[model samples]
Target: MSSLFGILSAAGQSLLTFQRGINSTNKNIANVSTEGYNREIPVFQDLPRSGVFMNKIIRVFDQSLFSRSIDLNQKLNSDNEFASGLSNIETIFNDALGTGFSSDLNTFFNSINDMLIKPDDLAARSQFLANAQTLVGKIRNTDKALEDLKQQTVLKVRDQINQINQITSQLAKLNQSIKTKTLDIEVNNEYLNERDRLIKQLSDLIDTKVVFNEDNTVNVFTAKGYGLVVGIESTQLSFETDSNGNAVVKWNNVADITKEIQNGQVGGNLKTIDKVNEQLNKLNDFVTVLTTVFNKVHRQGYGLDGSTNTDFFTIDPSKSGTKIDASNVYINITDPKKVALASDPKYLNSDNTNGKNLLGLKNNISNLYTNPSQPVLTPTEEANLKASLNDPTNYDFIKTHTFAEFYNTKLVAEVSSTSSYIKQQQQNNKYLYDAITEKMKSITGVNMDEELINLTKLQRSYEASARIITVTDELMQTILGLIK
Candidate 1:
């Protein structure tokens, strides 16, 4: 009877262990589709005498693989964000769309050339001013578009910082909870899953490194070594705006981390800000050169009204102290008779010398985007001049140094090259990211088929244990009846 009772006790414990195993397998199946969920596996230990006991629950996780996934996710996210923002900028300068500065610039100069046909025609001069206005409008609109991109970047940075803070806070809380739960040999798999999910999310916003402590708490920090969370204490991140209201990322509410964010969405936005600044500066330089060259020739010429020493383009007073180019360039003259087309006052209304001088700009090239050692005209610009040089008598004296040539060869080409490079980089990252993601899923993702097999195994063990208990009880009863 004593032996039967011992067997019965052992069977009961075995039954309970198998039941726990089944429960764990079921849990895995239930959460198979959950993002960042790891499969749960219940570990069993044999008792000193007999039977088995549930020792702990271990999540199917590969620490190294998971860490690598986080890093790759940061890079992938950064590249994707940059690609989207760059695409927006590329559209603003696309000459194929017919909305580029090149078209407007060509119209403005063509109007000036048209005036040479009817040097004293009010309608021709009026048309010149209209085209000039259109050119100014195009420039201003381009600047506005860039400014809008900057504003959008600021908003995106702010939002990303907010999300980072939120994620860190949650991670800190989960770290505390997981620590407490892990104090026992059997840790709570649910808390661990939640903690890992938050960590992954944080990784997507900014680059991060995670370290797990023996106490089950995790320490999180930026890849640059700034602490984000340590022992349940999370530091908050915020934006540090410049005087111009441009956003800069900060770590722990201090230190400008904008440049340090090398990967993730915040990194992408930071890079976009730099790109915007670069284009803005380039446009400003082009404006300075354009104004300087055009104004120099205009000052030497005589307007229809015998005007001299007047600039054709001037900066707007409202934009004083600003960069004072592109967005602010305005035509200086107000009178129709003030359109200068001649170098001599006696033939001011009939001479086409200044007009032809302006036309020469169409083919003039510089070392804008070429090697400094090679300052010769670009073949593309020369080809453009040749293509438009149908009438040598009408346009032969027309100079080859136009704004269109400089802009197309220098700024447009440079931006298009950048766009192509970024797109290629994005595609490479996408491929690498997809590969890493599959690796991570294979290591941690739940498989319902495997879970079902585990369930069946647990059911068989449970039934065998139940049968043992039943047989032990039956044998004890038979022995009792004999003794009675």
Candidate 2:
């Protein structure tokens, strides 16, 4: 179907095609260990009555695998943030760290029990006051710590939002470049690689959806259907603070869509802020109820100074309300002699009846320590308190237990349970995320062995094509000698 010159030209074309294939294999081998690198596949097309033609080189890509990987990565990041936040909260209440509120509470209550035995001893009374002061200081410090954590979460969220904006902008720019190259019928493997990498990065900061276009541009969106990028244009996300100082993710500063952002570091930071605030609220409530009940009983007793109605602990005057918060709790009475120890004693100096009565009040104080909202009660205390209330005759003052039973049973137990649940969730997420990530790598990742095999094949083809060119030249030389 062709002449000798045509045959020679065809052989030369075959040589070039094979060389290009070898070059592509070499590139693949070079980047085999590169992170996020995809294997380049060289395409070949048969020429019309010729040998072969080299087509464009494209990287091996699985769009579906890539999209799924993005989703899993976002969730993995969110779970990590959540687990770290829960650990921080656990540290706040960890008794092993020597900073737990439970320790201070136990010490203060033990000091009070000792005071009940030596109500007239001034030294015991002073120790009781000192322990109470220490307890208050611990509560205040804990509250401050939680506040600081909340602020940190807020700042992290703001930083994440900024990063997200930056990522989306870059994606938009890459989208435009890719579209232009594709429209011009140019090879765009580099642009495609960059775009895929950018999309994955965007998904890590925030959950994203990508829709590919015919022009090689992709439209990116938030999981909530907010457009991140459409063709060449992109929108930026921002955060607006609510009156409570909570950071709310906003779409163009128009709507409050904080709840829509889930499964990313941004979402996790917001959720962490909420978790920290929840624990802070519970601690404040405990402080309020403790101060209220203690002061209530102290009010019923007479001090050594014969003060009939003295408030041992006071709420801040500006913040005084029906309930006392930890931030506002203060020791109202300063004089150690002002410590109440008599309920209806004949002499304030010699009366241990009030101290004994205060101990008796511990049984009734179950109602104060047990948060009706949370309803976290020790089963025994709940049943006993119910029974005592129903039949006051069965109430035993000698068997009363207050602070120790309630504090451990309610707050400490709750923190432990929450921490355990968060840790389990993190482990499960990590396992799932790792499995998916490995799957994606297997699909798109370069294989050195496979590349070597391809390289050998290309080398053989190149040698064959070179031999054909040499044979054609030798035959032409022989024909020319015969003609001469």
Candidate 3:
């Protein structure tokens, strides 16, 4: 009787095993089309047989294979981040190419050259003034465009930081739930798969490393070495805007955590901001030099009609004192009544024989960007020129020089170089992003056909397992009736 009981118990265990197998296959088939879901397999182990009779079933998952899946997920995430950063930078630089400031600078100086050839013509003077206004407009437009780009970048950074915070919070909650569930091996595997998917998503926003603890909890850290998760809780990151409207990432109100978030989207954004700031500073310096030199020359030169002391171009004193507002700069030649041709024919003379005192100003304009060796005008020379313009000692010496050429050459070169460099960077970054994205797609992208095939396989397995359980139940019923 005991031997018969053992046989019945073994048969019952086999039936239960078949039922569990059927359930697992059905579950896999159901989730085949789900995003971020990995195919699951039920592992069966034989229980210790007594007198050659199998008694129980144990199901397990291959942890090594699961770990490999997690690794692949992380790689895909990093590739996505690199591709996104490159694409964004490309867009910014491409837009910068159409600023049009370089051409305006060239035209402004060309008009001045025309005026020099026909200084006696009032129309030529008027044309020079018109071109000057156009040049000012170009500078203002270019400055504004750069500022806009910078602001947009800041906003994007802020948005990304917010997303990071949200993702981290979700991950923490998921971790807690996973720990509390105390699920079977199959269910635990599912939890791990979900956790890895979330980690991959977080990786794209910022570079991170995931550490799986023995307790089935995961700890996350930035690639640059800042703790993002501890046990089942996650740290929060946020962005703060400074007075200049620049966005900065912070943790617990402590600024300067940017370095901790390296090799991810956040890192890419920070690098872009640094590059933009450098470019902005260089542009500001160029504008300051252009305005200061032009104003000095304009203050020295008398109008073509030899009017009393007045600056040919009006410069904003506010700009000269501190921050240079390229937008606010304007040509001060408001008095159309004061406009006149150079009074003396000798004004074109290089020597004192010419009434004009314009010396070296024309050469200065033409050589501004071309000749790096050109000496900057000294304070003493500037003061002397101012005094000479007030006293009118030698108009002949001034005739050879003018304000138009000097300002135009430097402005044109700076604008052209800046625009060109930005465009080139944009294109190069775009290519890199495309390449990385293609590689990532090959690795992480889902194949619907493959998934469908898997679904069919699971469906067949489930049916076969169900049939085994049904046969086992029929056998048990027959044996019970025969025993009765």
Lowest lDDT block of 10, candidate 1 = 389-398
Writing each residue's lDDT as its tens digit, candidate 3 over 1-484 gives: 4555565565456555645655656665576556555554445556654212222223223344434444443444433443454344334334257554555666765666655565556676677678778878776666676677668777878888888888888888888877786646666667766776677677657767677777667888766556778677888887887786666777756646865554456665665565455545444544544555555444444454555345444456545533344646667675533433233334622212111222233345322232236433565754544343312222222223433332333334434454465456546545655565444433433345654665565456545545654665677777789999
- The model with the greatest TM-score is 1
TM-score of each: 0.88, 0.86, 0.69
lDDT of each: 0.77, 0.75, 0.55
Q: Residue-wise lDDT of candidate 1 within 1-484, one digit each (tens)? A: 6778788999999999899899788877888888888887789999965799998888787887878788888888888887787777788888788557898888887787789897889898898888888888888888888889989898999999999999988888888787777544335677887888888888788988899887657899988888899888999987778986678777766787777887888888888887887777666656655665566557767888888878889988777743237778888887878877776688876886766665544455343211335433345644543443323221222234456655775557777787788788888878877888788787788877788888999999999999999988889889989999
State model 1's lDDT: 0.77
Q: Whole-model lDDT for model 2 versus the true structure? A: 0.75
Off by over 4 Å in 2: 182-187, 316-323, 360-363, 366-406, 474-484
**Cα error of candidate 2 at position 42, Å:** 1.7
Give the number of the best model, judged by lDDT. 1
Q: Provide the lowest-lDDT 10-residue window in model 2.
A: 390-399
Number of clashes in every candidate structure? Answer: 10, 0, 14
Better model by lDDT, 1 or 3?
1
RMSD of 3: 8.2
